[model samples]
Target: MKIRKQLPISALIAASALISTQAMAEVFVAPFGGYSFGASDFSITDEKTDELGSLKISESNHYGFMAGVTTKDPGDIYFLYSHQGTELRSGGSFSPNVITDLNVDYFHLGGSLYFPNGNLKPYVTASLGLTQMRPGDNYSTESRFSMGFGAGIEYQMTEAFSLFADARGYATFVNSSSALFCDGGDCLWSISSDIMWQGQANLGVKLKF
Candidate 1:
């Protein structure tokens, strides 16, 4: 019996003259727009609070821009940064009118192993960032630390142009100790701390300059 040893994609890419050699790399920028849907959990304490039932938020539409870098040498490493904003609409025990709308802005930065074959190139990426969540008029917005891990495919149209679609889950820990109500004032009691998760599927174009 023979045993096969496998190396990580990063190491493999570096070994293949993949994209980690060139010093003067060209920047790749793309204006992307996409939609996202996810759940948000609310925590209440023993103090004064509004009576609201378990809630669900409508699927949201988001838009943003992305910019990255591609090396001149095939074996060089690549990096990308993206910032997206979305509006959240919710209904249930809160103010159906005012509380229904909120804003969430997410930031992501990661590295990839490029396979510049033809029109399509498959790659894997890992990123860590943050999300600033604003739950509307009365609710206080909080910034949370997030992390993402995913893979996607990139298709090239010309030497300096391409199209890409990717699906990745982003999450972070929320510290609600100084929490306040979304409807009005400070919370009677604040939430301890917990983790929240969100996922996104996006399709956009990329240009290498």
Candidate 2:
């Protein structure tokens, strides 16, 4: 991703207000990197049997890209893919032990509604998608239906380039009462909640063509 030096906030706002209003449809791709955190804990069971203990998803850094088209309505319809590789740990009162490595990924089709202020635009976005959880140690991967929502802003630096940032929360629906991450008849864990929640924040440069 290409990043530019920062400009004074007053100059940015002033220049944004002075920019001409012309509507043109465009296509854009944004590559972003950020941190992922605040994932809800899961209840672990051994071999689809008794509950062993609680497990927590560790906070980690993630990266993704968004590709979409700009609408004449001054908004964007985009597809987003994000990924984080973290560990699941056994929860303890003192210190937790790393249980295994886990990878969380999101694939979504989403849209953003922009509130344009000249060269600066703030937007609200929402998406419906699937979340894939892959665990190490020969555990089976699981995919669940998920949804996300967020708000962010973009600064248009040029006709074909911009900078954007956003924070989004995702919820993946899972069977809280049943076994999960199973390979064959052997299952590793079961979640405590019917919905697993996680959040991410991203910053990137957008290229429009």
Best by TM-score: 2
List ranges where model 2 is wrong by over 4 Å: 1-23, 44-49, 92-95
- CA lDDT, candidate 2, residue 142: 82
Return the lDDT, model 1, position 200: 71
Error of 1 at 60 (Å): 0.9
lDDT of each: 0.62, 0.85
Instruction: Tell me the TM-score of each prediction against the true structure.
Output: 0.70, 0.82
RMSD per candidate (Å) reads: 8.9, 12.5
Tens-place lDDT per residue, model 2, 1-209, is 12343456667877766553233567889999999999987765554445466777899999999999887667889999999999978773324798679999999999999999999999999999999989898778889999999999999999899999999999999887877767676666665568888999899999998
lDDT of 1 by residue, 105-174 (tens): 7776766776767677877666777777766656666677888766678887887887888776777676
The positional error of residue 133 in candidate 1, measured at the CA in angstroms, is 0.8
Full-model lDDT, candidate 1: 0.62
Residue-level lDDT for 99 in candidate 1: 41
